[model samples]
Target chain A: MAGGGDELKLLGTFASPFVMRAKLALSFKGLSFEDVEEDLANKSQLLLESNPAEKKVPVLIHNGKPVCDSRVIVQYIDEAFSGNGAPLLPADPYERAVARFWAAYVDDKVLCHVLEAARGKTEEEKAEGLKQTLVAVETMEAAFKTCSKGKPFFGGDRVGYLDVTLGGLVVWVHAGAALYGMRLFDDAKSPFLAAWVERFGALDAAKAVLPAVERVVEFAKMRQAQAAAPATAGGN
Target chain B: MAGGGDELKLLGTFASPFVMRAKLALSFKGLSFEDVEEDLANKSQLLLESNPAEKKVPVLIHNGKPVCDSRVIVQYIDEAFSGNGAPLLPADPYERAVARFWAAYVDDKVLCHVLEAARGKTEEEKAEGLKQTLVAVETMEAAFKTCSKGKPFFGGDRVGYLDVTLGGLVVWVHAGAALYGMRLFDDAKSPFLAAWVERFGALDAAKAVLPAVERVVEFAKMRQAQAAAPATAGGN
Candidate 1:
C-alpha cells in the first residue's frame, strides 16, 4: 500500500471542487480509479453510508479503506503511493508542512469565504460577500507568488497537490459567479490570479475532471431561482 | 521515522485548542517531547520561519520536520508510530474514515459555530451566537450518543484521536464559557456530554497537558475585555 498499483475508487459529484481535488490527485499520481459520481441533491447510498456523519464527497476508497476529507485523501494518496506519478508533496518535511499549511489555508480561508460570498441573498449581502471574496483572492495571489515563485505551476514546472487543491476551485467559482451574474475575477484587479486560472484551465487532468461549465452554471441558476421563487408557485 | 522511539518536538501556545490536540496525542502515545511554547501574539522567529504561511501553533516537529494543522499532525503521528501508543485510529478503513469524519465534523461544524459564539461582540450578536452554539452542541450530543455507544471514549474503550481532539476543545469551551459568563454546557441539557466531559477531564494525559481551569478562565475574561475595549485601545 506504501508503493503503487492498488485498487482505487473515488466517490464524488461532478460540480464539487472537493470531489475534483481527489480526481485530480488520482490523475496526477497517474493512478487509475473507479470514479463514482454522486448526485449531491440525492446522494447515493454508498456515499451516505461511506460518509454518514458528513454525508459529503469526495470520499476516496483505497484498497478497501475509505478516506474522507479532500485534503486527507490527497495526503493518503501521496503516502500510499510514494513511488509512482509525481510526488504529491515534497519529500522534505518542512516543505511538506508548508504545503499542508497552504492546503488547509485554502480550505479554511479561501473556500469558506467564497462560499459565504456566494450565499449572500441581498444586494448589501452580496456586496459584503464580494469584498470578502476579493480579500481571499488577494491573499491567495500573494501566497501563489511565494509558492509558485514565478514557476508555471504550484509544484514548480509541474502541477502538484497544492495546485490541484487550489486550482480545482477556479472552475466552480467562475461557473457559479457567471450563473449568479457576479463579477468575481476581474483581470484588471487580480492579474496574477486571472493568469493562474487560465493556466489551470489549460491542464488536461483539470479538463477531464471538470464538469461542463455551462451545465454547472445552469444548475446553479436553476437552484437559485427555485430558492428565490414564491412558495405558492409550487416551485420546481 | 516509521516506528516508535523517534524524537518528537511540539511547537504550540498555551491557549489554542488545535495545539492542544497535538499535545494530547503526544501525551497519549506516552511519547516524551520538548514542548516549545510559542508566543502567538508575537510569534518567535522559529515559529514564524517554521510555518511562514499560516504562522499558527501546534506544529509537531517530529524528527526535525514540522507538521501543521492539528488533524494532519495527529494522523502523521499515528502513522509514523503505528504500534507504540494506543492506536489513534481504528484498524478497519471504514471505521478509520468514520473517526476522521467526526474529527472533521467537530472542527468544521462545532468549532466553527462555537468560535463565532465566543467572539460575539453585542448582546444581540451573543444571543444569536448562543442559539447557533446550542444547535451545534445538540447535534454533537446526538452524534456522540451514536459515536460513544458502549465505549469509554470515542474509540470505544480507549481514548482515540477523535476523543483527544474533542476532549481538548471541551476543556476550552467549558473554561472559556465559565470565565465569560456564558452558559455553554448546562447539565440538564447535555447530560451525556457533561458526563463525558468529566470522564475526559479525568484522563491522566488530559490532566497533564491541560492548563489550570483558572488560567484558561482568566485568559477568556481578558480576551472578552480586550474585545469590548474601545477602538482607540488598538484591539482588533
Candidate 2:
C-alpha cells in the first residue's frame, strides 16, 4: 500500500515491539506490505543489505528503497500516505517537536531502564534498577498529564506517535515486574501512566501486532532464570 | 524568527557541542534569539523547568514552549522556519528517514566511542577504545558515500542535518585524540571523513558554534590534566 500497490516489504522479527511499530503504522494507514520474519541471531541477506549499519530488523522497503528504524518507518508511512491515514505527528511544529522529544526520551530512558532492570541479577541491583525505572516512569507520568490533557490518547482519541512509542512499555511494565516480583506502575503513584497503558493496549493496531501477554510473561520468566544462573563456569 | 519575533530564547552553555547545534540552526535560519548561558554546575530554574526530565542544556524556548535535545531542536528550527533558510533536510520522505536514522546513529555510535576513547585510563584501554572508535568511524565512512554522492555536504552543498550532527564529531576527533595522544580520523584511513571535516569546518555556522582548534587543544590539555590528578584527596 505504501508503494501504491507496488512492492512494499517489511523485514522484522515476530516478538520485537519495535517491529510492531511499523506494522501498527501500516495497518492504521490501511496499507498492505509484505512482512518478512528475521532470525536476528543469523540475519538474512535482505536485513544486511537493507540496514547495513545496524543490520537490525524492522526495515521498511518501498519499491527498492529501504527505510530503517520503527519511528522513522512510521514517519515515512505518515508522510508517504499523507491524506490517506489519520496523521501520526501533529501538524504544528512545536507540538511535533514535543512528540519527537518524548519519542527519543522513551528510547533513551524508558526502554534502557526496563532492559537494565530486567538484567539485574540480585535483589540490591534489582532495587536500584527499579528505582531508576520509577524515575523514568514518573517523568512520563508528568509528561502524559502535560500533553494528553485528559484525552483518551496522546493524539486525543486517536492512537498516535507517543502511544505507539510507549506501547513497547506496556509489555515491559507487566513482564519486568513479574520477573522481579515488584510493581513498577502502581495506580496510586502513577495514575496517568496506569490509565494511559490501558488506553494504548486497547488499540486495534496494537492488539494486532503485539504478542499475547502470556508470551511476554514467559519471556520475562526466562530472563529471571538466566539472571539466576551462575556467572563463572569452567569446562576445562 | 521561529515565532515571528515572539521572544525566542536558547538556554545553553558555551562548551557544549549539543548546545552549539541549537545556535547553528538558529543562525542558519537568520533568526534572532536571546542566548542564556547556563552554569551547569548549579542549573538555573529556567533550565530545570525547560528540561526537567534530562536537566540538560540546549533547551530551545520559542515564546514559552521549550524543545529539548539538540537534533530535535534543529528539526524544530527547520520545520518552524522552512521558508526562511536553506532547507536542512531533503524534501523526499525516504531521504528524510535516512537522514534521521544517520543522525541517530551518529548520536548512538560516534559520540559514545569518542567519549570512551577520551576516558581511557591505560595504554591497553586506550588502544581498545581507539579501535572501537575507528570501527564506528568506519561505519560512517561507508554511510557518507551512500548518502552524499560526491556532494560537498550531506544536503548537497548546503549545511544540513547530517552535516551538523557529524560536525560535532570534528571537535571530538581533534579534542578526544589529543586528550589521549591518539588519532581517530586519519586521512589515509578515512579519506572522505578527513575531507568532510574540512568542508564542514569551512561553514560560517560551524565556525560560529564550534570552538577554535587552539581552544579545543587547550580543553584537551585540561582534560588530560584532570585525568592525571589523583581521584581521592583529603578535604580539610
Candidate 3:
C-alpha cells in the first residue's frame, strides 16, 4: 500500500551493519530521506506493519511502500534512484550476481559466526565461535582476492555493493574482537581486506552511515559485561 | 574461473525445492542444459568445487563458472536470457524488489517451518512446527494478497519470480501435508493462494520441473517411516 510520491524513508536502528546497508545506499545515491530510528527492544509499529513476516530492520520505504531486508533494500535503492549518484550494483549480470552472492555469504556464512564468537560466554563456546568466525573471514579473504584483484575497493574505484555490506559489519567485528581481546580480522592473514576496510571507512557514505568505533566497542563491552553478570550471579 | 562460450549445466537432486528453483528458471526460459544428479549423502566433487562456501546443490554452471544458491541463479538466468520464453523477474525495480522480497520470505520464513513440521517426531515438536508453519503460511497469504492484488499470479498472468520460488516448494508442501493427513494449504482459508497453486501447477514449467505428486508422497512416506523407525528402535 504505497502513497504516490517521491519521498524515501528508511527504518533503522543505530550501530547495526544491517541497517547501514539501506542508509549507505541512500547516501551513495545522494537521495535525501527520513531515517526512522527503531527501538529493537520494543520494535516500531512501522517495522511490524511493513515487514510482518520477518519483522526485521533495514526496511526502505519509498512513497509508503516498504522493501525489507538490507540486500533487497540496497538493490531497490540502486533501481529506484538510478538517476542519482554512483550505481550501487555493477551493470553486468554476472558481476551483479557475484556482488549479491558475496553479500549474502557475509550475512549467512560470516556474521553469524562472528556474533556467536563475540557473545560466547564459555571457553568451549568461544572456541567454536572463533573457528566458525575464522572460516567466514578466510572465505571473505578469498572473495576479496578474486573480486578486488589489485583494486582498492570491490567496486574498483569507489565503495560499491560488497564494500557497503562488509564495511558495515567490519566495525562491529572490530568492537566485538576488542571486547574479547581477540583478532577477528588478523592484519597479516587478510592484508588485502584490512587495507580495503581502511579505504572503505574513509568514504563519505561510510562516515555518514557507520557509528564511531568507540560507540561499537562500548556497546560490545556492555553486552559482554551483561553476558558475564548472569554467570557470576549464578555462581554466587 | 570461467571457461569461454555458453554451455549451461545444472547440478541438482530429484526432490529438492532449491534445485527445482534452478530447473524451473531454465524451464521457464526454454533453455536446454545438462542435469547432473548429486548424491547429497556423499556430495560430489563437482558440487563441492562449484560451491565451496555452502556446498549445497542447485548450482547453475555456465561455461565453467558456477552460480550457487537458487534465488541468485534464478536472477542470473533472467538477466542472462532476458530474450527468452518467460521473464522470471519484472522490468521495474520496485516490482523486482517486491518479488525478490517475497521469494526470499518463502526461503527464510515458509520452507523451513514446513520442512520441520513434515519431519517432526513427537506431538510437542509437531505443534511447534505447525505453529511456525502456519505463521509462514499466513504471512504468505498476506504477501499474495498484497503483491498479487487480485491477479491470477504474483506476476500478474504469467508465472513470475515469486511464482517460480513458491511453485518450486509447493510439491514438497503437498506431500508433507499428505504424509501427516493434514492440510497445509486449506482451500477455504487461502482461497486465492489455493487457486493460484492450481494455476501454477498446470503450467509447462511446473510440469517439466516437478515430479508427480505420487512420487513425492512416496518419498515423504519413506522419510516418515525412517523417522519413526529410529524412535521405535530406541524405545525397543
Q: Which candidate should be chosen as best, given TM-score against the real structure?
A: 2
Model 2, range B35-127, lDDT digits (tens) per residue? Answer: 898987688998998899999989998889889999999999999888886888888887898888988888788777666665767777867
Residue pairs with clashing backbones, model 2: none
Query: Highest lDDT, which number?
Result: 3
lDDT comparing candidate 3 with the true structure: 0.80
Candidate 3 lDDT tens digits, A28-145: 7777788888987789888999888788888888888888888888888888777777787888888888888998898887887776765677778867977987888888888898
In model 1, the clashing pairs are none
| Residue pairs clashing, model 3 | none
Task: Give a tens-digit lDDT track for model 2, residues A43-108.
Answer: 899899989888898999998989998888888888878867688888889888988899888878
Residue A197 miss distance in model 1 (angstroms): 4.2
Fnat of each prediction, in sequence: 0.22, 0.94, 0.75
lDDT of 1 by residue, B1-236 (tens): 54456778888877788888888887887777888888666788878776665678877887766677888788777766666667888775456656767787788877877777767677778678668778777867776777668677778888887898887686675785676665455578877777787888898988888777788778777777777788799543
Clashes of 3: 0
Q: Which candidate achieves the best DockQ against the true structure?
A: 2
Regions of model 3 farther than 4 Å from truth:
A1-5, A119-126, A223-236, B1-5, B119-126, B223-236
